[model samples]
Target: MKSLRACVAALAIATLGVLASPAAPAQAYPSPGIECYTIIDSNGNPQIHCIAVGALQEIDWCKGCPWAISFKDDIVFPETFDIDVIQGVENLSLAAAAADPRVAARFHDAAIADFASAARGLGKQTASPGPVGVYDTAHRKFVADNQSWLAAAGQDLADGLALLQKSFGSRDSAALVKAATAEFDEAFKEISGKQVIGG
Candidate 1:
């Protein structure tokens, strides 16, 4: 009878040990900081703003730190400003033109037409067909369908441009021209659904 009782106690102890083991850890969640600026239309008022991750430095939280600034509001310290990361539209135009003369000419014509149409559509906001209308065009349809791949290629071109700019400065017209050619080729390949012609 004692032996039977001892065996039962041992089994209970083993079961309790298994139950007390720690659970596996869960996956972590993304916590994005407000590092970029975006314009917001608040109550029919257009407001330019920058958001911060936390309270402002050397400022009391009780005073409402990291306050949102507006054009109508008083100027404050730690003002946010726009950084020209991609130079400007002028630079982009020149680069695009230098890269592929044919594509540049096409883009120029298309952009003018698109802008005029978009502006007209904007006047009648109800008429704006949005992405569907934009994708209706044959050229734009291909871009919409293969957006992810094209975006990756675009990023690659941007990175190459950044490298060239860093090493040779923006004055290196030759490098800029070369980078533009590469960008055009990438875009062409993406649009044509053809393998890259060369390395």
Candidate 2:
């Protein structure tokens, strides 16, 4: 979604550049008279434009100027409106997420619980493995201070799912789960090393 907004903004800037760009010296020679006219811009504002007045045959070619552009369609960015709507929805979600730390904490806890539940299949096909280690004191403090969600959730979620494939319904499941923590030790370290950020 962010990329989509960026592309739209870039396209709009390019279009403005096009409209503002001077069409290369339309008239090679001076004309006998000057023609002046007023045009309504995309903004519904009046724009005054004057051009060399001459007969179609008398003039070789009269490339339009930005002040008096004669393009078939007006410059318009319909996507901007869509982006505005999307941003409104995004703003609401962002505000809700930042309202408190409960959401982030819950999400982290849920992911760990999933790991703990599936961790017993490490060594044996039907054998139970050891308990999953809890977050250390430092990691718990780091998380409490963060009051935020991790943008890295996507990768973490993927890792957890991959761990499941190793531990669940596999030979020596306990070993497989242990090997996956993403091995538990690494997850513990990750939580401790994770950074705290402010909104």
Candidate with top lDDT is 2
Q: Which ten residues in a row have the lowest lDDT in candidate 1?
A: 3-12
Per-residue lDDT of model 1, residues 88-137, tens digit only: 21233332333345555565444333222322322322111111001111
lDDT of 2 at 150: 21
What TM-score fits each model? Answer: 0.23, 0.23
Tell me the number of clashing residue pairs for each predicted model: 0, 9
> Model 2 compared with the native: what TM-score?
0.23
The CA lDDT at 171 in model 1 is 72
Clashes of 1: 0
Give the Å error, residue 61, model 1: 48
RMSD of each: 27.4, 28.2
lDDT of 2 by residue, 1-199 (tens): 0111111000001111111222333322222223223333334333333322121111112222111111113223232322221222222222223224555345434544444443332222221111111112222211111111122221342254356556567788777655553433232222223322222
- Residue 155 of model 2 has an lDDT of 31
What lDDT would candidate 2 get against the real structure? 0.28
- In model 1, the clashing pairs are none
